[model samples]
Structure formats: structure tokens, C-alpha cells
Target: MQELEEILRAHAARYPAMEAADYVKLIYQNEFGGCPAAARDGEKERAVPPAGGPLCEPIGGGLCRVHLAALPQGAGPALDRLALATAREAAGSRERFLQKLELLRGLCAAGQLPLDSAALEAFLAQGGAAGPCPPHSGAYQAAYAPGYRVLRQSYADMLPAFLEAERVAARGGVLALDGRCASGKSTLAELIGRVYGCPVFHLDDYFLPPELRTPERFAQPGGNVHYERFEQEILRPFTGGGEVVFRAFDCHAMAMRPPVTVPTAPFAVAEGCYALHPSLRGYYAGAVFLTHTPEKQRQRLMARSPKMLERFEKEWIPLEERYFSACGVEQFCGVTVDTTDLF
Candidate 1:
């Protein structure tokens, strides 16, 4: 633990974004190289699983045998102490027990313990209620919330169009990122902004006020958003290179919040449902429409905001369908992307 602390203190600048658990992994890997060099690529993959044996494809980065326990510690550290408690009981005899001991000692001969301790400390610090479980018991996703899990995906498909738009919109222009609900449009837009060096506008911020949610208004395609206000305050000014200040409608408070003045930028990503609406179409330099299966969208909506499902089914989904179909939003976009193609 002291050695781990020393390294953390010495190299803290190197791993500015690395969490405590990741540091522990470096120690463990340096010491054990858990998945041996030769075992990594083909030999293990070629071996067939025994009939009826269970198989699991772990996502994200691979874990070591120590982390195989699925300790809430994550990819942090795999220590001998944990192994002793976890594995010593399974050893059939003294020789087997000594062999496991030797393995641990040999692996920890350097400074792998750093990985082990930092991970544990971070886990405890994060309010993870640690508990003991039998070895080989499955690691549960319920151990953490979905928000804690990172969504990784390639920008290869969207990059070309995005870069082209950035070039075209060098002075200023709108890139409309429209998509199916819960299809990750917002996250994708943010990623685009990071790479393209632009700002992102979430049209969700201009949701229709309670007063505007009348039956007749709801009947109109894409009538849910207060697009009139959005266009005047956000779309128009941003696309036209004017001084811009806009207020985000507070859904919970059912009122408009204070306005924020946006600085001028080379490009802007307008992301959300109805971002490419017929009324706002001319404001965009380019648009990307994201698609997803209804089942997958429902699954995401259920996990993301369970309470919104009833409203989405009864009102929002139908409204979006009418809007997308009548306006030909999918066809209108310059690029079409499937959510499954990414993470």
C-alpha cells in the first residue's frame, strides 16, 4: 500500500484522468501479466468449450484471474490476500496450497500490490458495500448503475461527414443531429463537439411549456417542441452569426429558466428530437439522422427513464412517428447512422 501511494504521488501527473483502480491494474499487470503473452491471441480462443459449459463474453477491457472474482474493485488490483481467502479453501492439499502461494509470491515479487490496494481503497471510498461470495459465482451488473459504465464506440462512420461539415462551417453553421429517442444522439453530439471543436445545443432545452401542451397543438406533427421560440433564440442566432442568449425551459418547474449567453464558435451541433424539423431545416449546414430498433429504443428508455415510458408510448412516440414520416426527416438528413453500429 505504501509503495502504491508512493507511485501515485510520484506519477500522479502522468495519470491525471486515471482513477485509483486503474493504477492498481498497472501494478498487477506488471507483476503477473495474468493472461500470458502466448495465451492472449489464439491458443485459448481455439480451445473449444466443454459441452454444456457456460460461456461469458466480458465487455470493456479484459480482467485478470484475480479480477475474475468480479470484485467491485473493478480492474484495479488482484491481491494474494484476496486470493488466499478466495482460493485457499479450494486447494485440495498442502502441495496445491503451496503452489498457489508460490504463484502469488512470484507475481508480487515486484510491486503489483500497488494495483491491488489502490483499487480496494477506491472501491471502499466510492461507498461500494463490499461482501463475500463463493468463488465462480457470477459477477452481477447490478453491483453498479449503468451510468457508471462507460459507453465506447467508434466515430469512423460519422467522422467523415462531421469533419466535412466542420470544414464547411468554419465561420459558423448548424449541424443537426436528429435521432430516435434514447438512441444516444446527445452523447454522440457531445463527442462530435469534442473532436470538431464546436458547441452543442440540446433542443430538449426548449421543450413546450405546459400551457402549449393543448390537444390541438399535440395533434400537429412535431408540435411538442416550442420550435418558434427555439428558432428565434437559438437556431436563428447561431446559424446567422448573431449575438445569442437563450433560456432552457425547466420541465420540472414548468417554467423558463434564466438565459445563458453563448459565445461565438466555428460550428454548433444541434442535437435532439425534431432538431431537423421542416421549419428549422434551412438553418442547418448538414444533418445526421440516427436510427434504432423499437425494441432497443424501448429497452434504453426503460433503463434510462422508466417513468417516461407511459407518456412516450401514449403520446411522444406517435407524435415523433408522424413528424418523421410527414417531414421525411430520415431522408432529409445528409447522413444516416444506426445506433447498433456504435457501442
Candidate 2:
């Protein structure tokens, strides 16, 4: 609708260089009823319309609802092929809707079809009539190709940075790599450690013991695994020029594993999903944020692990958005590596 486009355009203007895909994700989350794909048996069909004002029911069901309105014109067949591919890739009755979305994006980019609501609806209807299906070769190949390139290029381009950081560390400077989940933080961390010959410590090791991992605090909106004991036992000791034993957290066991003494090595690499927490900012000499376009992030996640795509989109992404808004680290990052350039 004209109103939706106007709103998105206004919002995009506020954030320099924000892409159409990012706007699409934002609109899909805020203005639409967010849900996973509907069941193939039509058990989850429901009339969903655009939010904020009255709009026509472009499509019914979960996946179709958000995507139908977002796609451009004449992209129906490609969307259908993408849906079938997603259904086949995801086992059981549950569907990996985001995977299909990535596939549709590839089709749109490749000029295989024009994007539009009619095309999306028609594709869904056709898929429904065809019953259960198998994955499409084109869809799978196209969807994952770019992601593979991204991963490969990120690792490759990161080598020089890792070496530079290592050289700095050898001269007594600390390097900090920070980013949201699946933003290639860990891979970069590992690469940095290898290049610098430094010990790598993952913050996941410092989480509270499993028995204490109650849903009480973590279950709340904006809740995070913040354990004071972790700060005292792990973070303080290491950063204060003292040797501390490192114990990895066992999520399944809900306890810390046997403690392993990690000698205080110069140029230690402390990396995790939350490595750039404000509390630890002052200790790093240099920092880098691996920034990825939301579309690329979604595509990479779907390619690596289809099941995680749903959780990332529905739960993790909102939390991450909140975290970045609160921390405002984007403004302070010394270096930013745009993953798109590498891909």
C-alpha cells in the first residue's frame, strides 16, 4: 500500500544506507501478525491483513501473509518454487519459511520472476494443490550460494585484520571483535586466535550453572544471562593481570565443567556472542563490528541451520535490536567490516 511504503521510506531515511530488505523485515515484524509458516494441511489458515489501517487480505496463513504483500510483481512461480523447496528441506509438518524467503529473494535477484502479491498467492495455491513436495535444485543451490561466498570471504578478508591485531597484541595491545549472533563473531575470533597464537575464551563458559539457569530472569523480555559470579570469577581475574581457571558452561548439565587453569597469556582473545558488553569496552585496545545486511544474515542462518532461522527471526532478532539500541556500540566501533563487500 502507498501508506506502508511512505512509512517505510520515512523510517529508512532516518537510518542512512538502510536497504529495502531491512525495511521489509521491519514492516513484516511490526505491521504484520508474526508467525511461522502455516501447516501444509491448511490447519493454520487465517485472514491476515496489513496493520496500522484497513487493507485487503492479500493472502491467508502465516508465511503467505507477510511475504505476499512484500514481494514485487510477477514473481508468483518463483515464489511457489521457493515454497516447495522450503517444505521439502524442512522435515515433519513444520516449515522453514525463512529459507523459502531466501530462495524467493535469489529468484528475484536473478531476474527469474518479478515480485508481487498475486505471484506469491498463486504460488502458495499451486503448492497447496500439489500436496507434499520435494526440494527444488535451483532453489537450494541459489539460496545457499551467496551465503557460502559470504562465509568464505569473511574468513579470507579477516586474515589481514587478524594478523594486524596479533602484531598489536605482541606489542601489548588487545583486540576485541564484537557482533550479534551469527554475525561471524566466533569465526573471526577463532581466526584471530590462530593468527596471534593466543588463547581464546568464549563467554558462554561463564554463564551461571545450569540449576541456576532458571527461566525467571532469562524468560523475561530483554532478559540476558548476566551472572555476577561470572564477572568476578572469570572476567575480573583475567583482565586484572591474574591467572584464572576457565570452566566451560554445560547447558545440558546446567553446571560448570571441571576447571582448567588458563595461564595469563599476553594477547588473550576473549570472544563470545556478547563480547562487546559495555562493561568490557574499556579493556580493549581496538574493536571491530562485523556488520551484515539483514537479508544476508537471514540467508546465511538458513543455509547453516534451517531450524535456527525461525528462532533468529522471531525471538533473537528483536532482542538483538534492543541490545544494539541500548548499547549504541555502532557509533563507537573503531573498525567496521561490511560483510557484503567480502561476499
Highest lDDT, which number? 1
- Assess the local accuracy of residue 151 in candidate 2 as a C-alpha lDDT between 0 and 100: 14
Off by over 4 Å in 1: 1-152, 157-171
Measured with C-alpha atoms, the lDDT of residue 181 in candidate 1 is: 88
Tens digits of per-residue lDDT, candidate 1, 1-343, equal 3343344444333323434333333333223332222222111212332223222211212222221222223211112222222222232243432343344333334444333444454553663312121111012112211111111113333433444455456546888888788877887787676655677889899899988989998887888899999899988887777768999999999988998998877678889998987899998888888888888888888988999899998878888889999889999987777875444
TM-score top scorer: 1
- Tens digits of per-residue lDDT for model 2 on 1-343? 3444344444434333333333333333222222125212121123222234222211212122222333334333333333333333323222333444444445445544334444444554555213332222233223321110001222235533544464447566456666666677777787666545677777666665555556785653324545455456656777777886767777778766898887776667666645666766677666777778888888888888998789989977776667666777666666677765444
Candidate 2 residue runs with Cα over 4 Å from true position: 1-156, 163-173, 208-223, 227-230, 341-343
RMSD per candidate (Å) reads 16.0, 18.3
